[model samples]
Target: MKLKQITEVRYITRDWDRSTVKRVVKKLTNGKFVRKNSGPNTFYYNVPDIEYALDNLNVQFGEPATKGHYRTSQGDAAYYIWVVSGWKFKLSAMDMKLEVWPSGDISDKHNHFRDRYDR
Candidate 1:
């Protein structure tokens, strides 16, 4: 599916604690919302399409996103800047705009959807 067409996707937030990561996975991959199987831990939720979307997005926008650091650095500095350069993106659902945050966290505020929707 096109990222722009995913207008009302679920926003799965974790519990903040370490176990929250697991909870967030459950929130995103629960069988109630996806396909069901016999054993609780035996099944897996597969979303190859999401991976495809991310790959396409990175290919389309990754170089442009890293150009800022490329132009600033001459030699060795460029190598250092490359460490975290893969975290940039142009979220199609979030207005098809460039977003550059230190952490790779995508919050509702970053998408400008705070006022329009519940977080």
Candidate 2:
């Protein structure tokens, strides 16, 4: 999607990490850069097609903490593997997006990103 498509944005006006929030917005909006506006002190970005993202990706909340979280062990195992496999993640009210790497490199960045939001 084009970068300027992100139109609607929402955020809590408490103390938050600026760069991390922007990164999440950019990812959710398909890499579009987010800018701040003054009128009421809001930080917003563009999503070329929010419907497409909402419709296409398999958005999910907290990982299945246990086997009960998944319908089957296979699913749970897969989820566990994916979580530990070092994918950069950003979670929103919508779903979680993993910044997958070409070589499948899982690193501390994933945890750092997760820690920023999963308080």
Candidate 3:
């Protein structure tokens, strides 16, 4: 829970580490960079459903440093980025568009992204 400025407490995942968060965020470069494509170009969902995804992100990773967030239409997607530990966290919302690095060990994340955001 957020405490006084002198002593704020944040509940994070068991494996959560600031360095890990930074590392992962850096891999994306930013919200628009992807290395390899694995899923369909885009998946359309209701706005509330996508919003639930956003809420679930907060529950999973604590709150991120909310950055630019804008939604156009249901099918017309836009990024809702967040900065955590000085890194741009692009995968917070399922609306995220990511390209996985073929040589990296982040295939699981890619799969999770596809599963959650896929129709």
Query: Which segments of model 1 are wrong by more than 4 Å?
Result: 1-22, 26-35, 52-119
- Tens digits of per-residue lDDT for model 2, 18-111: 4544544455546343433312223433446545443323232134222223345434311211121222232132222322222233355555
State every prediction's TM-score relative to the real structure: 0.17, 0.29, 0.29
Tens-place lDDT per residue, model 3, 1-106, is 3212111113342333444443343322223323243223221222334454455445544664444445566544445544332233343244544322222224
Q: What is the C-alpha lDDT of each candidate?
A: 0.30, 0.34, 0.38
Please write out the lDDT profile of model 1 over residues 1-119, one tens digit for every residue: 33332211223233133233223333332212133432332222333333453444443333333322223233322211111221322222212122222333355546555556764
TM-score for candidate 3, please give it: 0.29
The C-alpha stretches of model 3 lying farther than 4 A from their native spots are: 1-19, 22-53, 60-75, 91-119
Q: What is the C-alpha RMSD of each candidate to the true structure, in Å?
A: 14.8, 13.9, 14.6
Candidate 1 vs candidate 2, TM-score winner:
2
| Candidate 2, poorest ten consecutive residues by summed lDDT | 77-86
